[model samples]
Target: MKPHRYQGSALLLALCCSAGLFLTSPVVAEESLEQRVTRMEKLLESQGLVDLYLRLEALQQEVQMLRGEVEQHGFDMKGIKQRQRDLYLDIDRRLGQLENGRPAVSPGSPAKLPESTAPTAPREQGNPATANPGTEEKAYREAFDLLKEGRYEPARNRFTDFVVRYPNSGYADNAQYWIGEINYVTRAFEQAIVEFQKVLDNYSSSQKQADALLKIGYCHYELKNFAKAREALQAVITRFPKTTPAGLAEKRLQQLKNQGQ
Candidate 1:
């Protein structure tokens, strides 16, 4: 009976210990579980891995930054291209404007070209085969025909008109060259010199430039402007030494030297 009582007391102690372990352990575990759940929720929010709206806001910020950088890069590239184009244009203009290049002449200024100042003929009464002319070459041909036909004044008038009507035209340079030729034929050496000078000063790229220099030197020789003639003739030789103009300059310079000595 005493043994049975002690066994019962042992059973009661065991039950108490089991109950204390369960209560204390579950309470602590419950608090820890709540804290762990709260921390997981905060971490999920920070990761932006859930909730469509917050993710979209973060994605939008990234997209906007990328767009801004792309736009800025495009603007910077455009500015660099524009600057390169401007520099190229400036260099091209300078290269083309070399020796004998006349400064940009203002309109209505006294330095206004004499051929440029000549009067125009009325468009009406133009001859057949010379009529219906729309371009500079046609006009120049018509003028050359008139000059050959001994119509001196009309030819001069036509050439002057050609030069004025198409100032930058390819044939306009030829028209100026012809004016000097006409003046040389008529023995107006001073006027011939002036017209030929215009070709050299204004049309550096013209095919007739070398001829213009030759003619100008000839004009100076005719007028007995020997020093001026020597300068013009020598330039023809120096500038176009491989061409017919240079040959003519060398021959004439020798003649002038022979006359002097």
Candidate 2:
């Protein structure tokens, strides 16, 4: 009876131990599976962070390239604006020249002649000097009017008629001067020189002497006679020191010196 009792107690203890081991093994397996799943989740988050960093770097590079292109375009726009301003200034200068009717001369050239305010009618009398005072003025005024109107040929003819019809008239020198002016303005430099010389030769007392000399110098310059141009310009400065033409001649001389002429 004592042996049987000991055997039964040993069997019961063995069965209890097996049941405890079974339950604890399932709990350990569940904990291991949870740890593995947590590790996988951490690895996936790290990979996503690396991909986002690479995309950000690429976007920054594209922004830098776009900024460089914008700067280049801005530089090109500045150049285009400068060219447009230069073009506008050039057009304005050309239009001003056209409206003036006189060719654009060099920087130190003579100024344009004054416009003549005179009538446009022929004299009915034969001799201009011996004729009535009003008739003489009318004849001179009519000839001058033609010159003011840019009728060069008719002006030349009328002046020639006046000089012939009234040799001793006070306005004869003025008429001759206009003839030279007509030639000078028309670019007939040689003819202008001849006509202007007549003013110095025949009308020494006339006030147009300085003006004629100045034109002579200008004509010589156009003809490329530098020596004669210098001589004539120098003569103007010496002969008419206080005159406006003298100042013009001085300016021209300075220009020549600057040019090494």
Candidate 2 error regions (>4 Å)? 1-129
Candidate 1 error regions (>4 Å): 1-135
Lowest summed lDDT across 10 adjacent residues in model 2 is found at: 111-120
TM-score of 2: 0.51
Writing each residue's lDDT as its tens digit, candidate 2 over 64-122 gives: 99999999998888965764564345334433433353233344443232222121123
TM-score of each: 0.48, 0.51
C-alpha lDDT of residue 43 in model 1: 96
lDDT of candidates 1 onward, in order: 0.70, 0.73
